[model samples]
Target chain A: MRWVDLVKVEARIAPLKAARPGDGRGSQSARVSVTETGGQLSRSSTGGVARLVAGGVWTIATADRLEPSIDEAVNTLRGTVEIDLGSIVQIDTAGAWLITRLERELSARGVSVSLVSASENARRLLEALAPAERDVPPPPETIGVVQELLEAVGRTMVRSWEDLKSGLGILGGVVRGLSIGLRHPRRMRFTSIIFHMEQTGLRAVPIIALMSFLIGAIIAQQSAYQLAYFGADIFVVDLVGILVLRELGVLLTAIMVAGRSGSAFTAEIGSMKMREEIDALSVIGLDPLHVLILPRLIALILVLPLLTFIADVCALAGGGMMSWAYLGLPPDTFITRLRDAVALNTLFVGLIKAPFMALIIGIVAAAEGLRVAGSAESLGTHTTSSVVKSIFMVIVVDGIFAMYFAAVRY
Target chain B: MRGAGKNPEEVIRGRGITVGFGDRLILDNLDIDVYRGEILGVVGASGTGKSVLLRTILGLQPMRAGEVEVLGVPYSDAAPAARSAVDRRLGVLFQHGALFSSLTVLQNVQVPMREHLRLSPRLMDELARLKIELVGLAPDAADKMPSELSGGMIKRAGLARALALDPDIVFLDEPTSGLDPIGAADFDALIETLRDTLGLTVFMVTHDLDSLYTACDRIAVLGDRRVLIEGTMGDMMAFNHPWVQQYFRGTRARRLGA
Candidate 1:
């Protein structure tokens, strides 16, 4: 009846187990035969004393598997429960925890549970983990939905305001850098400007040309279908030529450049910011605006008009070819009608908008890039916002130019 | 884990594990075993294939030879079902805090549970929140993406996801590397508490000497294309191996009270 003596009994059984040549596992004899190695709880009654026997590896490895069974057994127990660990060869913190949880459960049922013949290691591990387990703090509370929405709105407003300020700062710095370079022309980085030109301009040529060509062909074809009913089919050449030379040519090219070069600039600047490369450049006494942004902006400004011209020529050729195919007019006849309908000043007006639009796209992209924070998510958000903002700015600039030319009758 | 069968002392056993890329042999005929319910720290100089060894045991990297057994099952030879079942019982913590940048902290912790269990959304939410709190993260962190969390917070959130499944073995890769001294000590203590409370067997790859002395129950050194030595801290200090001697008795080691 002295359950405290079970540890002594286990110690005593060790030599006896050794005496039996095949008893290497030592004193594994079970009272109720719970055979599972993961864990098993069995009921036993010795001389009217109700008891529970725990056997097998009662550790975290077996926690998920053994937890339900432990719960079930704890539920079935009544009154005072004496838990025997004499058969438990291995027990971990989870196993010890389960035993403790069972004890608590039993106590709740008005039944006191006592552990018997537990290993010293299990006792120590349980003791180490027990004190801290009760202090597992509750999760932090979330604010109300209304507060969260307000907070989000406030954060976005603050971020956008900061973005706007940074954009102005960068634009002012670019202007100052441009003025400084203008005064000291020999000191300016011509090679860097040319490289950026190749990147933002020269390289954009083929795609722009092909895209413009397709647009012109589509416009001429679509115009021919409607105009044939009015017997103004030959005027398809005039419409395609004027639209391509004046508005569609530069507007489409600017949009494409905004998509391509603007995004690339943002990503490049954003990554540089993320890596602290921009900071490193400053530490070395280099002005990033003068060294980096100026070249890109200038190159974009220089090449956009050239790209627009290329788009206009390709589009006119496409319109001429489509006029011959769809309106049954010869190529020479289409060319002659195009020349008569479009004026030189219209071409000049569209070309005049290109540099300003390019400037907007480059400045917005570079500014967003410079604004990028340390996270990959920040880089991505800035890149997307950069393209969107610049494309918007480009269209606005084009609209202003259109108004300026219309009011002047130029 | 590729090594087969569990010895009385072994929970993770790797025998003659040979890993190489192209012609360069990284770990050649390596033999090591992680005892059950102990924090076994695997230490080596950088580029010594310590991570590679851990990867090989987890079956992330291919082994040219040798086998490993984890939780008493052969990892490589087991059927996909059996392997994944074993995988469910294990978790890995990366050193660089590679939490998915897009997902909220709660969603990250729920990833494994959602994949393996068809628990209801409310239940999953409760369980995921419990895990985040268990790792000592703020509850508000559950709604925040990985990008929003600070460096230490990211690691703790990553730990929450690793412990979501209540795994038996959690492999920690330099858990305390980037943390400040106090933060590192707190992290080490957390690892110990989880081990004691959960009965987890930890296999950690680390260069932190404080972790080696305070957290790890046993230390295994990887060098010369295999496990150079495996023993307690005392054994490491007493060993005659040149690199081990320099590592354990170095100036940095002295600062760690080694």
Candidate 2:
């Protein structure tokens, strides 16, 4: 009984020896004559015997149609049988399936099947039947170009609709607030008056003072040199005063406040909104509009006008310094000329534009701020928008005021 | 919890509460009544409307269809002054505590008292310190900012702030979330003690098992679009509902020491 335990086999199977036809070796068969009593087997040929005893021989040949001979040989093995699977050079699934069934049936019958030698293809075929072996399924298909395009289009449409809806909702709230303000005139008017004082008159001081001081220094430097050339240096006092009172004073103050306070209002309210504090207020039975917006609006309005007045004084002082250096005009002489160059109407025109610009800044910044949602990311976006919108609106309002003042003068 | 001896009916009653977000129904015709000095826990998976329920009742979120009566005050029908008067009767510990980052712990705790009552600075400071002490934080912790405290410490500070007003009804959202097990257990003990000592009607939303077992007088299991079952721990343990059974059973599939 030539028994082999291929089930626990670990060693790599050596290659097969192919016998050429008509080389005194049988064409149809290669036989090993075993001396059963000695428990040793030898090949028929002298060369085959030497190689068999020296290196253990195996065969390789195709099974063209020898099913009967193969079945008969496998059945005659009563104890155990080892096949030189290296001989199986060509075998279809038909042959492979037969081998598998035979292995299972013979093992159950206490007849073990072993591989003395196995070809690469035969081992692969046999291993495929092992329980854990499986084919790796192909990857998921790529999304088609048309499908990708359609999905992108769908997402864009959804986003656009969401943006439009949010815009409409905010616009509706603004319109409602305005309508109520109109219907309740006395309340709105009083609020407007107070806010004008705070936002426009009062809060615009520091920036106005700083800017006017810088402007005056620049004007003094430029005029002093120019006046030296003309030898009419003293007239620059009138020049500085006229420019300060007529234009730069109010315009500079308005632009400064628009950037400073406007961005501040937006970021503050926007952050409050992002934290759901606004909603928290409403939930507690407090009107968020009255509590948050009204006070801020009033503060800006009340401050702007006062700031414009301060800005005028500072700009003139700056101009006076320039005049004193260039035109040999003292601070007293500069003030006297300033008093003569522009009258009450110039101050009134500048102050009038201050409140309008203040209103534009307040409304635009507060509106943009209240629109903030989500996290800190949205906070940055709303703050930027608030500053930009406030500045733009302030400039536009200033243009309208300029137009009206121009028309009146004409 | 001073009203510990009072009957359960006198606690908090919510009638026909229905809230919606635009067209999506968040809560529909929901009614919850928490007994005096009882810890009522609201439990559910994420997005099952647990937080919404807490908000609507706390008056931090609006009620589209129902009335919330806290203590004896009819909060829904109350005027602004009356509503504020009602708000004065309750305290809220938000999920994130929502402590003012600008104010110190003591100032945060003293806010409601300063706004609604006139107390001497000394008295206010004493009260704030007392509340902080009750929450097991150092008296010196009162001067620190909310950002300076750990997660558990922030929650304790928030609890102190909530307890400042000596509110009868306290609403806490996920009080033990983000805390370690031991810290969470300590928080549970603190909550249980607060319920006992203050005689507060506690309405809490949480997913913590220890809190449900140790603190809650009764548990409401919110699932399948509604509260499928609500009962004491003993009753909940015996609940035959598939979700409840599976939840209590947990994953017993793995063999130990295999």
Scored by TM-score, the top model is 1
User: Could you tell me the interface RMSD of model 2?
Assistant: 45.4
Per-residue alpha-carbon lDDT of model 2 for A201-270, expressed as tens digits? 5555666798888786677677778877888676676666666666677777877887887888788888
Say which docking band candidate 2 falls in: incorrect
For model 1 chain A, give the 10-residue run with minimal summed lDDT.
A17-26
- Tell me the number of clashing residue pairs for each predicted model: 5, 34
Q: Please give the C-alpha DockQ score of model 2.
A: 0.01
Off by over 4 Å in 2: A1-410, B1-7, B252-258
- Quality of model 1 by C-alpha lDDT: 0.78
Candidates' TM-scores?
0.74, 0.42
Q: At residue A174, what lDDT does model 2 achieve?
A: 48
TM-score of 1: 0.74
Query: Tens digit of lDDT per residue, candidate 1, span B1-258?
Result: 111124334668788899999999999999988766678899999999999998999998998899988766788677886677678768889987778766788889989877765444644575576667667877677889786788889889989888876676899988988899999999999988777655577899999999988989889999999888888899998999899999999998887783
For every model in order, the fraction of real contacts preserved is 0.09, 0.00
